[model samples]
Target: MSYELQALIGPAELVAVAAAEVPAARPRLLAQGLALIPATPEFLAAFRVGDEATAAPAAAVSPSGTAASAGFDWFPGGLERRLAAWSKAGPIACVEADYFGGTGTQRAAVWADGRLDLGPITSAELEPFPPEGSPISRALRRLGARVTEGDDAVRDEFDAVGLGAHRATVSWVSAG
Candidate 1:
């Protein structure tokens, strides 16, 4: 399985967190404001963000969207990177996406204040965004901000934008 992730990070610290935590991978530039990071299955299995274990399941956004029933661990190295990079940015919003098991996709939107909305956009509603970008990239770009993917060496590239960092939070959901 392969998981592709796209995040709209708000607050500079959140971008730092994502940069630090997001597994090393090459991302594609979807537009001026969006980037897509693809991850290996092993990394996906170890992904976890703040308060995720205690987070409640979010409602399904589409027929295929479902709440996650179990907890998963974030890789130690990734988690440490996030903590180490915490800093200040203006308020920022993020959309974290994951795709696995063929057509299945899952998504969550994290707010700087620690609220998270989890689910996937309806496939029909996501037609304009190509596979190269994923639905989240399109949604983030629509906000009229600029986003880009960083290479392995510059994962914290988003932090340079001065957007405030969020108090990381995640709500897990599944979609097919």
Candidate 2:
């Protein structure tokens, strides 16, 4: 199976703030009781109201009580400011992954306390299981995803969080 996703993951309350601001935002649930708000195409269009150059929509997830928001302009001035504002509550991660038949690229960045805490880290398509501290792994760790003992199949924070449950951002919307 292939996977394609772009999202912001952070605290549930902070994510709710993002959802409330968007027009027609829908919430879904992921494994481990995480909340997900898929940034449907409509919502992305609304989020880009003032900034036409925005690349994606905004989404968030939390650690204790996770939340996922799919599709955000991962790195744009306006969105960065907004993410900084949201980070006042806690860390927020912008993660993008696209794997065609289990081989593709992944990258992520994190904001916390109004600052860029982690990456802008990128992983090559050939390195599916990036070593510790890789972009997505670090970002997921920042968001509180953890590896359990003796789970050989679940290698990193990404697997720990069960993000592969959905194939795309639109799937999240349809599931909602």
lDDT (tens digit, per residue) of candidate 2 on 1-176: 88888776776666787778765667565444445566456654554567654443333321121122322234333456577787888787777878897688877878889877876677887875545756777887887777899989887777777776789978877765
Worst 10 residues of 1 by lDDT: 167-176
Taking the candidates one at a time, how many backbone clashes does each contain? 19, 14
Q: Best TM-score goes to which candidate?
A: 2
lDDT of each: 0.33, 0.66
Off by over 4 Å in 2: 31-34, 51-77, 128-130
Index of the highest-lDDT prediction: 2
